[model samples]
Target: MPAKVGAVKVNNVGNSSVFNIGDVYSMSPESTAKTYAGGGSFITGDGIRIRLGQSTTYVTDKDKLDQNIT
Candidate 1:
């Protein structure tokens, strides 16, 4: 019904983030990131050259009700 907060301090808040000091119904944070790195190359038998690269994906939420789909 009521909330009381004393001295508070915050350092930082990132994108798609939430900071609650009091009561709340709900909170959802979503984020997606992709990265790639390569240091080598390869050639196919058909004489086609291809570069090899490593990749990674990070997702906070695959499906969020706030956005419907992710």
Candidate 2:
């Protein structure tokens, strides 16, 4: 099983003006001391869904925004 390294929360309702449909985001832990990796997901109020892994590239539609952590 993958270890739980960190947690993330996406707040679209709080900043709806800056967020849009199909927007994607990713997050990871700050420390690399642990051998296992971590990831998370969330669905925004605008029907935008985001899925993330430890080390993966984020892609989205042309009209959407993509944010990821290296």
- Strongest candidate by TM-score: 1
Candidate 1 segments exceeding 4 Å error: 37-70
Q: What's the CA RMSD of model 2 in angstroms?
A: 21.9
CA lDDT, candidate 2, residue 14: 45
Summed backbone clashes in each candidate are 0, 0
TM-score per candidate: 0.44, 0.14
TM-score of 1: 0.44
Query: How would you encode candidate 2's per-residue C-alpha lDDT over 1-70 as one tens digit per residue?
Result: 4345455556544422343334337533342221332343333377565554355535435754345335
Across 1-70, the per-residue lDDT of candidate 1 in tens digits comes to 8799999999998777889998888887777654343343222376565644664444465654443435
Clashing pairs in 1: none
The stretch of ten residues in a row with the least summed lDDT in candidate 2 is 29-38
What TM value does model 2 have?
Answer: 0.14
Best by lDDT: 1
lDDT of 1 at 9: 91
